[model samples]
Target: MRNSLRFKVALFFSVLTIALLLAQALGVRALAEAQEERLIAALIRDDMTNVLKGYQANPALLPPFDVRMNGYVSGADRESVALPATVRNLPFGTHEIIIDEREIHVAIAPMGTAGTARLYRVYDFNIYEKHFKEVINALMGGTGIFALLTIWLSFGLSGLLVRQVAGLARQVKTLRLGESAPIQPGKYDETELAGLVEAFNDYHQRMAGMIAREKAFTGNVSHELRTPLTTIKTSCELLEQDAAIRGKSRARLQQIERAADNMRELANALLMLAREDSACEVEPVAMAKMIETALTPFADRLAQKGLQTTIDIDGDLHVMANRPALAIVLSNLVDNAVRHTDRGGLHFRYAEGWLSIEDTGPGIPAHAIPHVFDRFYQAGSPDASPAGVGIGLSIVRKLCERYGWPIEIGSEPGQGTRVSLRLPAASRT
Candidate 1:
């Protein structure tokens, strides 16, 4: 959740709001405190000036004494108006000092006709300071509450900000390979968001055009190749009927026929892959019968290599699947086993909807196992012998994926290889 865009946006807003609010609170507090201090200091200075002038004009006139204000002059009834030691040493200026554990602001000025004696005017500001602090505390408390409210509002605002983006993502998820319609840019109100949707629509149209071209190319090529393949098969059949074609000549002719059949199957498989959906008809296929038919193509190769073969599938075992797709899968698996295994045998077994092919070939390398199903990926160095252009397993994987079948391959360096397919079970015929 922390990695989500909404979460990140909310966090960004939260940090920004906190910083702005804290700065605002501090700035207001400092400004208010400075203004109050300046006003209080000016009042003290004015009171001191008035008292000094009155005593200067009339030597007998005494300074006013009040609860919030008091005046005292040095060398004039010094014993009766006792001054604090801290106040007596003060120069002619305004000063703040503690008197009897209370805060006092004092303004000292010159007094007497000779301008030698100092006059001190004291103002006790403890009560006013207490009230000022109370007001500041309430302001700070309100600011704190407002800050929390702003943080909550930030989450809601962030969600609104990204709602269109989230909706775009949901639309993208619903898109199919080539069948989905483009998102309408007019749906979004923001210019940037509308532009983004337009860009996506352009990209989607380009991809769909490419897919259409590829499908057309594959369909045409497959259709065109079938003609030559059919002609070759028919010619081979006519040549085989003639008794003059014997021994090596007859065997070569058979090879040509087999090659033509394999070519046709390959073209069909490629055509099927190019289409968005399979065109092959689905039916209940007898597992053992399909295995026997698939082994026919590689029978000569197995005999040439002197390798054995075994089948342990029940005659009645059947699976619900597309026949041609399953045929291509089994043909590829058997062909791979035959190509690799030169010494030992091949085993085929079926149980609980899983059909497995076990080969005694020198097993695939552990590091290469993961990539065996990738298109055009072969084990060993480039200088080594090639392995059928490496599309056999890739085709099988694609077919299995298209049909929602589960397939797996397991092998060790020299312990042989095993490929398994879990098919949909059907009632025995």
Candidate 2:
């Protein structure tokens, strides 16, 4: 809750409002107290004047007056009046005193000739203190109510703003080329928010259009290339059957056949990748058979390099995957292994739900391992053999990701490299 924007805004507003209210309350209380003191002083002065005039007219009228007021004749030693020493020494003017926890306002004046007697009017301020307490209580109560209202308003407004931002974030997160609709500007009232929505919508549309165009281009190109690739493969097969062909011509024809077959496989893989839909059907495939099919195109090169290959899997062991995509993945791994290994062999192992391909090639550098699966990212030294473009592992990674297979690569310098893929348990079952 503390991390929430709404909570922070509300807390800030509440604190600011409470501080302002407290300051205003103190200022108002001070002003009221000052005005009340002046009013009390004026009333006390007028009442004292009246009492002095009454006493001069008739001395008997001074003893019994308003009970809230106490009159004292200084120098007469009136012991029943209960005046404090501070009030007794005060010069002839209005002053304040506290006696027995009760605040009193005192007014003094000359009562007779040549300082013979002095008149004192004392007014108890306990009633005024009670009233002041009531006022303070009311002010505090109102301040609390206003503070609560301010907090509620701040939270409500901040929540509305945060929700709008969250909505925008959710839209962006779920945005996909053909799956999500573009954001509508009219949904937002604020000018800046509307502008942002419109801008995102424009960018989204452009990106979706570009993707569609690229997919169509790739599909069309792959379709066009397949015809010639099949024709070339057929021609190579026919030429290899001819008895007139010599050793060099036959080898060249065989190379052409392998190249055409590789191109066809690559085209099929690219076509599969370019399609956005992932509704391809998966079926049980024998692990050994899949490995054998992948290794066929590289058999001549592997043999020429004097490299032995091993497949360690029970013939009954199988996995479930889309045939073409999985074939592309395996073929790419095998091709990379054959191209890079100078004199060592290839090994494939399948156990439970894990498949591993280890190659005795100069291992990938530590720095290059992280980027090995990036498109067109070649590993190893700069002087390494340029047998294949760097997309082989990238294709392998993509296929693994699409099928929800986890892949890991480990390598050590001059020791070789190992690639492991963990398929779903359901695939093995």
Candidate 3:
């Protein structure tokens, strides 16, 4: 919660409110105290004048006295009157002093010949000072309450501020490529929010157009390429029946047919991968049969290398997968293993839902194993295989990702490599 924008906004408002209220509370207290002091000073001045007049008329007259006010007079000699040392020598003016820890405001006035006689009036309004403090404390308490309320309201306001952004995030999260309509900017009233929505809409349209163009290009290219391949395979079959094509000639014809078949498979795989809506129907596929079919093109190379082969899978074990996609994945893996292995055999094993292919080839380096599935990242030597453009494992990974299959590779420098696939488990055939 502290990391959220709403929380930060609320905290900002809370701090600002508290600071403003505290400053206002202090200002009000200072003003009230200053005004009280001025009022006391003014009353003292009036009392001084009255004391001078009363002494002139009656000679022994004293000034008024109350819980909040006091009066004193001094003789012309200044020593005849018993005045506090702090105020005795103060000139004929009002002055404030602390006498016995109590605040006092003293006012002095002159009268009689040569202004020798002086009237001193001191006022103590500590009682009212205490009440003033109580009022200030109450004001501060009220300010605190208001600040807290403002903080709570700020949290609610922040939620309203981010509501549109949260809604937009939900829409983007659920959006599917080339399936959903563009987000409408008109729904948002704020100019910045509307502009943001419009930008996203533009991006969505561009991505959809690019995907459509890619599907069209792949589809067209694959169609155009496969036509010639199909014709060549048909022509090879017709020639194989003729007695004139024998021995080496028949062998060459068979190789040509196999090449055409492999090319057609490549085109189909590329086409399926390029289209966004190319989800194929899944069914129970015989894993052993599919493996044998994938290895057919590599048979000659396997024989030439004198490499042994082991298939430790149950013939009746079937897996749930798209036939064409699984075929391509198997073919790529088999081709990679065959081209690299010179003296050792290829081993296939199945357990539970996982099918693993272990090869006795010069194993991939530990450092290079991580990038073996990356496109165009050749882990073998340049002369390893003519068709090793480094895209085989990349395609296998992509198909497995699309179909939710799990694939992993483990290898050591001299111990060969093992590639594992976690396919959907099906009932035994």
Order the numbered candidates by TM-score, best leading. 2, 1, 3
Candidate 3: which pairs clash? none
Go through the candidates in order and give each one's C-alpha lDDT: 0.82, 0.78, 0.80
Q: Name the better of 2 and 3 by TM-score.
A: 2
Identify the leading candidate in terms of TM-score.
Answer: 2
**Residue-pair clashes, model 2:** 0
Q: Write the per-residue lDDT of candidate 3 for residues 206-298, one digit (tens) a residue.
A: 988998888788878977898899899999979988998888988888878877876787777778787655556788999899998988888
For model 2, the stretches where C-alpha displacement exceeds 4 angstroms are 1-134, 150-208, 279-292, 303-323, 349-354, 380-385, 398-406, 427-429
Tell me the number of clashing residue pairs for each predicted model: 0, 0, 0
Worst-scoring 10-residue span by lDDT in model 1: 69-78
Poorest 10 consecutive residues of model 2 by lDDT? 68-77
Candidates, ranked, lDDT = 1, 3, 2
- For lDDT, the strongest prediction is 1
TM-score of each: 0.63, 0.64, 0.63
Across 49-72, the per-residue lDDT of candidate 2 in tens digits comes to 777887889877555432232334
